[model samples]
Target: MDFSHWLLLFCTLLAFYNLGIIWFGQIVVYPLFAKVGAEEYITYHTFYSSQIPLPVILPGFAHFLLPIALIFYRPEPVSLGLALANAACGLLSLVVTVALEIPRHNRLEKGGKQEDVIRELIRYNWPRTFSIMGSAFLTLMMLMQAFSPTI
Candidate 1:
């Protein structure tokens, strides 16, 4: 119930939540992009973008930062290494989101749902999705390690 503990709980919760989203996105959401009508695509994409920031961005950014904080404050080498891995994954996800996915979404908004673009988005998203799951695994490992008895 210290700061590091709080941060760990928050990061762990968020990481799992993001893992759920990642699966849903890869399996359901992104695939449906092609089905939206060209005229309505922008509106749909706009609404999606508008709504996702809170659930997605807030936790994601927090998760990214939490690991670094843990590294400094907790300083348990095993958990710290896991935290670093989580942070690295989180950072890569953010970079991919901003650099690749968002622009693709924007293009889809303007140009209307191109199959190629949609396919590209889906293709490009695999790394970020896997990264989030990896982060979740690391977060879980860190939490378990923190709670377990030390030999």
Candidate 2:
């Protein structure tokens, strides 16, 4: 009904959007990397890498800003601790992306379909996937708390 609520909704939407993408990557896409024949992997990976960034960067950039905004402008009933917790979940996703997952993606892109790399990609991906999932839940809870009228 107001700016804080809107902020929470937008942040929640971004978290859910990222949650869907990451889960799909976790459950379907990453594991399937090994099945692609080596010769075709580069091409497949190229296409995948190209297509992925828009989905990632658009929300990612806003996702970055929104959590910081949450820290400052959290709605009624969304405590400072809850806001910080939501931001931490977002931070975890970012740290995992910048530190772990991106390198593995680049390795697969450059080195072709190394099974070890794919396996590590899948293995390393669990944290980001679940954190975004956690982010989504945190945002939802924030919304419910903001909107609900007592008990």
Candidate 3:
């Protein structure tokens, strides 16, 4: 209802949104990178890279910032520790994305879908994927703790 409440809802929604997208990439999209034939791989990957930013970057950047906001504006029943944990998880995911995943993607983009690069993308993605999963879990816990009926 207030700022913190609104932030919690937004953060929770974003957490699950990120979780879904990352999981889909981990389970489906990244694996299929290997299947895109060498001939079409460049074209397909170029299109994929072009289209992905909208879905991936916007919510991801929002998710990154909202947790930091949560540290300052956590809703009722959400402790400072929980807020810090949420922020940490978001940071971990971002670090993994920037440090580990992006370079692999860059390699694939430049080299035109080398199997090693694709494999690294999938393998290096685990930390970010798991961090998102952790963020989702923490946000879910916060939501329940904040909104559960007083008994």
Backbone clash numbers for all candidates listed: 0, 0, 0
**Ranking of all predicted structures according to TM-score, beginning with the best and ending with the worst:** 3, 2, 1
lDDT of 1 by residue, 34-71 (tens): 88888798888888878888887687677656666666
The local distance difference test score of model 1 is: 0.81
Better candidate number, 1 or 3, judged by lDDT: 3
Provide the overall lDDT of each model, using Cα atoms, as 2-decimal numbers.
0.81, 0.85, 0.87
Over 1-151, each residue of candidate 3 has an lDDT whose tens digit, in order, gives 7888888998999999999999999999999999999988888888888998889988987886689998888876888888889899999988888898888887777779699888889998998888889999999888887787877
Better of 1 and 2 by lDDT: 2
Of the two candidates 1 and 3, the one with more favorable TM-score, higher being better, is 3
User: Local error of candidate 2 at 61, Å?
Assistant: 4.5
| Residue 86 lDDT (model 2) | 84
True-vs-predicted CA distance for residue 103, candidate 3, Å = 1.2
35-74 per-residue lDDT for model 2 (tens digits): 9999999989989989977887678656755787998888
Candidate 3, pairs of clashing residues: none
User: Residue 2: error of model 3 in Å?
Assistant: 0.4
